[model samples]
Target: MTGPVLYGIPNCDTVKRALAWLEDRGIEHRFHDFKKGGVPADRMDYWIAALGWEALLNRQGTTWRKLDDAVKAGVTDAASARAAMTAHVSLIRRPVVEWPSGEITVGFTHDSFKQHTREALM
Candidate 1:
């Protein structure tokens, strides 16, 4: 089977760390750089359905912090969240992993990733 698709900004520190972790474990993945390629609104909507707006949006990032108050206030809904994510790609959480089997996960932790990889490999 093909590897998972890992979406995030290449230069993001968290994404770098996640990539390194995956490499160390010999987990195959394809990287999609949000800054260069841009995320589609439809894909964002799908993720939102699976992960919810709160999980998909990276509120801790500088891009989120710099968002206009109006935009911030409007981000409660999927449409508004998609707009925000489109306007500031960095606000979408880093290292969003979509497995070949159609499982979608956000962010990365070594332990959680290991479990997911084990399940996927099985």
Candidate 2:
């Protein structure tokens, strides 16, 4: 079965776990390393449109925590959030899986992955 494009920093524990889960399940996914490849602006735009910036942004992460107070404060709406995410990809959630069927998901969870797979298979 065709898998999704899993985008995240390799060192992130969440991303590592997601990758391990895929490997353990004999799933094939394309890994996009944020550090090396940088965020794809067009893909980001699509995700922002579909998921909304609030849903895609990782406000609880260290990256968001480390941002300047002003920068953090500036992300008040979808447009601002997208701008912030464009400037700092780490602010975007991890393991953003763009499935073979063009469905996009943020974050990683067993149930979520299963659902995505089911949707793709359909």
Candidate 3:
């Protein structure tokens, strides 16, 4: 909660890569595994408030793709999306990081990660 808290399933390729990136850079962080520990509703609420449900939702992922058309269509707004994300944790984007600066980012990108950790690196 203090430094950086990275939330994702460890086995995910993107999550694994992000973890490696953090480790290789010596960036201290706490990892919250969605598989081991279910998504925290409070934190999920915070993420929704900060980043918006659309930003956290992974509609392009296999989970979403595999969902029934009715289920997919049910996710029409924040409340619906939250329900979908909560019901199917995989629907949430990978590596939702809460940075030391209180910035929340969904997903990982090399440049974006570098930018987010610039101060910590400095």
Task: Using lDDT, give the best candidate's number.
Answer: 3
| Residue range 1-122, candidate 1, lDDT tens digits | 47778999888888898899888878888898888889976778889899888888888878888888887888888778878888888889878988777899888888868877888878
Whichever of 1 and 3 has more TM-score, that candidate is 3
Winner by TM-score: 3
What's the TM for model 1? 0.91
Please provide, for model 2 over 20-57, each residue's C-alpha lDDT reduced to its tens digit, 9 standing for 90 to 100: 98888787789999889999989888898898888899
* Colliding pairs, model 2: none
TM-score of each: 0.91, 0.90, 0.94
Error of 1 at 80 (Å): 0.6
Candidate 2 vs candidate 3: the TM-score winner is: 3
lDDT of each candidate versus the true structure: 0.85, 0.87, 0.89
lDDT string for model 3 (66-106, tens) is 99999988888889999999889999999999998888888
Clashes of 2: 0
Model 3 local distance difference test score: 0.89
Q: What TM-score would you give candidate 3 relative to the actual structure? A: 0.94
